[model samples]
Target: MKINWKLKLGSRKFWALIAGVATSILAAGGAGDDTTLKVTGIIGAVGSCVVYMLAEAYTDAGNSGGSESKDSAAE
Candidate 1:
């Protein structure tokens, strides 16, 4: 099967699902509230960064004729 990594990585729902699963697993393993919260926060922060970077890259590519963004051009 083919996967769209760029789109998938930029999705909030995808990241939230990951955080939810991680939180559930952590809680099941007896992790403390603070630890779980930290993990969740990190995940959210990283997810936001990923989305921002993808957006910026796509925007730059669109604005610059995909000169430096061959990876995001057409595929």
Candidate 2:
């Protein structure tokens, strides 16, 4: 199967997920003792979920070829 690697790399959701993973790793690697790093990691993970949801919503809306009015309303 052909994978759309470009699409994945271009996605904000993908970047968010990467950031989340990086932060989580940092937190686990001795940085977790620091409250700020722990908090940052948690926030990064939550932000990734939010970004993924938003990205999926936009992708679905675009694919459905919905009305511009609906899109404008969302904005």
Candidate 3:
């Protein structure tokens, strides 16, 4: 069986992982207060949504025979 790591970026699990990492970074930075945690959660949610949208757009473009590259979009 072969695994494609790139495809995982479009998964909710990957987004949740990103959110978890963001939460950990915030805690480590001494911003573990309730308000800060809420703000971090909001930011993580927004970030994940943006990533998902971009991934969807990329997939759509590819399916349409467009030559859009993820690297270029990231920049």
Model 3: C-alpha RMSD to truth? 9.5
Better candidate number, 1 or 3, judged by TM-score: 1
**Per-model lDDT:** 0.93, 0.69, 0.73
Model 3 C-alpha lDDT per residue in residues 10-69, reported as the tens digit of each score: 576776777788778878888857856797678677767767787888888787664446
Estimate the lDDT of model 2: 0.69
Candidate 1 global TM-score: 0.83
- Which structure among the candidates has the greatest TM-score? 1
lDDT of 1: 0.93
Evaluate candidate 2 by giving its C-alpha RMSD to the native, one decimal: 8.0
Off by over 4 Å in 1: 66-75
lDDT of 1 by residue, 1-75 (tens): 999999999999999999999999999999999999999999999999999999999998787885647757746
Top candidate (lDDT): 1
1-75, model 2: which lDDT tens digit per residue? 898764675566667667667777776675645664666667676666766776787799787776776788899
